[model samples]
Target: MPQHLTIVTHPLVSHKLTIMRKKETSTAGFRKLLREISLLLAYEVTRELPLTTETIETPIETMEAPVIEGRKLALVSILRAGNGLLDGILELIPAARVGFIGLYRDPETLQPVEYYKKLPEHMEDRYTIVVDPMLATGNSSVAAIDMLKAAGAKNIRFLCLLASPEGVARMKAAHPDVPVVTAALDRGLDDHGYIVPGLGDAGDRMFGTR
Candidate 1:
């Protein structure tokens, strides 16, 4: 319900998201749920993508069918956790370009520091979507957007599984131009900078790491 944020409320998306919130959900179950939810979420994020028609001969006759226009989209995952979301989106946008932006928060400073970034060429032309599971503190999200903007990415959208109110506010304040699409917007961040009632560390839950 927050401005500049799209909360996907499809029955299927909500159902899958409920499964992910439960602590007992196994790693495999969690991953599968995430993938399913990502597909639905992707549909919402790309709803406004520009389209053009190309005339093609059908079995019966030639017709103009709408197709996505311009350069292939750029999907930039925010390191390990983002990869999970990226995989499901790829199923829908198989030909989209892939990229990665890695950032880790310093424990003491609580600020994001970039460890790696490798993006596709012509990002300025392609519509870019940044993926991450949880938007808890929003530091990394802001930093990632900063990098994308600096790299000539003009149009960008943020996609995630869950988001905290604090994170949404932070992102809104930092980059109002970017629209955020997510399955659910949780309460807020806890003292430890974790989303309250969140599905826990997404990277750990998905990868089964301690």
Candidate 2:
């Protein structure tokens, strides 16, 4: 079984995350780094995927080769910032079915408001992964997972570039069955509900909106 929370500590992941966190990193640079780092995170998130062996004939002999079991897994991006991580993970798992849940946080309430949702079919038969860039207050992440569960996604995992203790704890309380995979778990959320020392507004940095 996968741990409830897995922080990817690989040197390459760490180095790329450091570059991404720099305030001076250009939008192009930040976007490029996010794609690179996300691939590394995807590696860790899928580490425990079940595998089954199949007999195959090699040039020299016949042997059993392990292959991922079950139907193609689903990648559900919690949109806007989630697309950054989604693109890279798709590069690593091209055949995985894709889905999207569009949610925006209400500035006044800091609550998630769902605007759109389109998920692949047979979610219950697939291992679903919900990707988002930052897990701040965890309200949005929790809401996104709730939508997935309602759509029949029983086996699910959450992936992000950065997380906060408050956010992680909220997820644990709301959905203990799903595991979390992230590049880093930062200090905590600020009064405004942003992760402290975080790479300032992932969507803005990636898209140069700010």
Residue 51 error for model 1, in Å? 0.5
**RMSD per prediction, one decimal?**
1.6, 0.9
Per residue, candidate 2 scores C-alpha lDDT tens digits across 1-96 of 678999999999999999999999999999999999989899888887889999999999999999999999899999899999999999999999
User: How many angstroms is residue 181 displaced in model 1 relative to the true structure, after the best TM-score fit?
Assistant: 0.5
lDDT digits (tens) for residues 4-53 of candidate 1? 99999999999998999899999999999999889999999898888999
lDDT, residue 122, model 2: 97
**Which portions of model 2 show Cα errors greater than 4 Å?**
none
Question: Could you tell me which 10 consecutive residues in candidate 1 have the lowest summed lDDT?
Answer: 1-10
